[model samples]
Target chain A: MQITVLAGGVGGARFVRGLLSHLRTRDDAEQTSVTVVGNTGDDITLVGLRVCPDLDTLLYTLGDGVDEGQGWGRAQESTRVAGELATLGVGPDWFTLGDLDLATHLARSRWLAQGLTLSEVTARLAQRWGLPDRGVRLLPATDTPIETHVVVDDGEGGERAIHFQEWWVRHGASLPARRFTVAGLGEAKAAPHVLDALRTADVVLFPPSNPVVSIGIILGVPGVREALRGTRAPVVGVSPLLGGRPVRGHADACLAPLGVEVSAAGVAGLYADFLDGWLVDDADAGLRYPAGAQVRSMDLLMRDTEGAARLAGAALDLGRELSPVGAGTRGPR
Target chain B: MQITVLAGGVGGARFVRGLLSHLRTRDDAEQTSVTVVGNTGDDITLVGLRVCPDLDTLLYTLGDGVDEGQGWGRAQESTRVAGELATLGVGPDWFTLGDLDLATHLARSRWLAQGLTLSEVTARLAQRWGLPDRGVRLLPATDTPIETHVVVDDGEGGERAIHFQEWWVRHGASLPARRFTVAGLGEAKAAPHVLDALRTADVVLFPPSNPVVSIGIILGVPGVREALRGTRAPVVGVSPLLGGRPVRGHADACLAPLGVEVSAAGVAGLYADFLDGWLVDDADAGLRYPAGAQVRSMDLLMRDTEGAARLAGAALDLGRELSPVGAGTRGPR
Candidate 1:
């Protein structure tokens, strides 16, 4: 299967890992190529070093470098830099940089300074650790930098913007944002491989990543949404929301700002144009989509890599079934 | 009393800490300025962040922010960055950065990007923590970004050039460097206040830092040695070496490259012409100096702030005792 996975942070990374494990077990790994388009909306430049929190999270997690404790940064990390920054009175104190994780950011920043695009940098870094090549590839959504900023009332009546990382990682979505903007999206172009990956895909899988911000932001990139719409392949999306709320993250708060209900149906509507199939949890099987996008419910929690691959396999099967070659297609063929 | 101390690394920083402590205990709350001209030989841009090890040592030691474990960098530091860098296979692993220490470099890098000089950046950072105003100043000896490179035999009888930080920190001075070059020293000028500070000095104290590479390199700066020679103030130097070896650092090896002995007498001879008094350890009291210089012996081991102050006070006292005024001469009469 030629699969393209639209991803966000921890959840996306976890699902990718699961998909890798399953592909390896299936013995058809050589045939399946997984292209992950990562979210860069949470990127920030702190003290002059550019930090891509979500991208790093995905890379570290999938590369088996993630700290087991946090499941975000690398394992065996230390917070020496954070402590020093604190002493210097700089904060979003809640987020800590593990020692092992800093290396990725440093290398990324160094490479970026040397004139490499984010896509090129991502490819080089992934090749360094040899991410599962049997069916796996990681790509950034755009060449131009895009920052997701949330506008919140700055303790008074007036509203100001805070970087997405600060709002998500630091505030933990405790404060509500009046609105959100994907800054620089006007100038952003989809990564070189994104359109090609989407067009040639047998299945386009939207992993259970942040909908309003992460995967949504990737789909918003120029040419990506259009590519998916024109794809001859089936498109399936796994819902990040389950039972009308997020298992993690403030997706509900985020959804409220966009007027999207906190349910699989609500999220499915956002990707409704090209989504041929929607995967929700068994708990939300009772839910209905008015436009009647082919829907199924499964055990969607990716508790382990095996579970992630299981969910991936099921989604792929559903997408295949929904396509012209699938069981649900008309008998004309 | 305005006091200027020429410093290198650990020993120099400790001595200045003592000086800062002594200044605090004075009967009068009047200004007791301390101008520290820190050695820049060890400076190198690793992954492009300028790190000043010795200067930061002095800053952290005096302000109670130093890591007591290593007596350098900040306290409660983490190593997430170091671990990550190691994983990424960056060089000079021996000169590792605590995560907290990286914040200083990152902040300094950021400030430098905004057109701030190292001196201005250092002052701004010092102000954040409220450093003692006895005119506390940390200067980089010169404004130019001159790097020190070491040439070592390449095992095939040819010499290979490596940065000073790599040679010293990584190799642990195990390999011999045929030469140490402070590239661009001939054209370098003492950063604005250096000459003015030295010329107006009531006393000049050379802390027990690596004299050959530290103080020697500073003296190599154009118009700097001249400033010291032309000053009416007495310059007193404390020996980094006691009997024949340095208590810390590979001063012995550094001196060998310069054909100077690793002894109190050797250092005294180097500074003799412009020196007023040379302080050696009591064990090295019999050490001799060149013509026209007085010699004194004291406990120069600055184990803590009290020890630092005592040594600093001793240097100050030696300065007054050797000067024309204290000697009851009419302005060198």
Candidate 2:
């Protein structure tokens, strides 16, 4: 089976880990392949280094080098560089980057400065983590620069837009966001192999990640949504919300700014144009989704790797059941 | 009094610290201003950051942040970033850059990228360390790229040139250097204020630094040597050698490649055309020097900051004695 996932940072990383674990247990695991199209809206330049938080999170988590406690950044990381940078009065003091993580940014930024695409740089980093050895491939959603910015009240009569990281990390998303703007979205095309991954995949899964910025940013790319709508694969999505609150992060805050109800059905409706199957928490089982999509309820909270694997298994089952050709089509793409 | 000193790394840093201490004890201490022309020949781009080892040493040593025990680098420094970079296979594994030091480089590189000259960057860094408040100014010998490379046997049959840092730090200068070449020397002009500092000085001193690479490279810059020769201020130098061996670093090895005897007289002879006075260790007191230059023997070893100050006081007294118009000829230029 060829499974492709649209992922964000922490939540998507956990889901991808679970999905990889689920595939590992199958007898024909060698025949299974996974491709992850990671969100690039969260990328930022810190101290002249290009930092892709979501991509680094995925690599560190899957490579077993992530700090499990924080659910992001490298294990055994030190903030000496960041502390010194603060002492030097350079960069944003609020965004604390670890020394080991800064090395990744340095390497990636150097390569990018040498004219490599984001997809190429991501592949180089993933290879260092041996992602390919585990039958997994990670690519950015778009190679073009596409940053997510939040328009928030500047605390006076007017409003100003700030980088998504400033809103999420610095402000804790406390300030009311007037709207979210995807900068460069109109010019961004899917990264190399992204369209192909969607078009040729047996199944596509959206993990319990923020619908607006994570998968939504990926869908915002010029050709991504068209690829999903035209692909023969069944697209399945898991709810990022439970009991009208996010399982992790401030997905509710993100949805509220868009005037969308903070519920499973609301998240599902955002993807109703292409979503064939939707998975919500048991608490939200009775919530009505769009007409054509098959709805199911299961344990969606990924508390641990084992829980993630179980959740991933549930999503896979739903995607397989929704496929017109069923489990093993044996068709060569 | 306006004093200008030519400096290198560790030894020069120790000498400058002593000079500052000597000036501090004077009644007109606040009136004494010192300008140091730092060697940039040892600089290398490690991991894309322009690292000036000598300049950093001068800043850290005077700023009380240097590792006193090691005589270079920051105190209580961590190499977490260097370790991570090695793991990523990004930079030279043998050259370990501490996390705190890397911050300086990153800030400098970022500023340089933003179009700041190396001299401007050095001043910015010095101000951060409060050097300006202490009446000390540090400037690079030249703003142009003038790296020293040593031609050595490739260990096969032919010879190849390698960066001075690689030759010094990695090989420990074990390979016999056929000759030393200062790359970009022809194009390197004295950095801003170098000539002004030299020409308008009450006295000029050459601290016991490596003659071949450090002070030699500085003199090689167009107009620097001419300024020293034309300046009315008495030029005095402290020997970096004591019994035919340098107080610190591989000065002897550097001298050997050029057939210059690693002795006090040999070093003083190189500057005979411009030097008005030379200070050698008591052990080499009987040694003969070139004509027209007064020679004195003193305790040149800077065992501590106090010892360094005493030595610096001796150099100042010798410079005053050599001046045609004695000590208090405070004539307006």
Which candidate leads the pack in DockQ? Answer: 2
For residues A139-165, write the lDDT of model 1, one tens digit per residue: 899879999999999877788998887
- DockQ of prediction 2: 0.74
Once fitted onto the true fold, the runs of candidate 2 whose alpha carbons sit more than 4 angstroms away are A155-158, A330-333, B154-158, B328-333
Docking class of 1: medium
Model 1 residue B300 CA deviation (Å) reads 6.1
- Each candidate's root-mean-square deviation in Å? 4.0, 2.1
**Complex DockQ per candidate:** 0.53, 0.74
The pairs that clash in candidate 2 are none
Error of 2 at A298 (Å): 2.1
Writing each residue's lDDT as its tens digit, candidate 2 over A26-57 gives 88689999999999998888888889999999
| lDDT tens digits by residue: candidate 1, B161-195 | 88887888788777897888888888887887898
Please report the candidate that would top lDDT against the real structure: 2
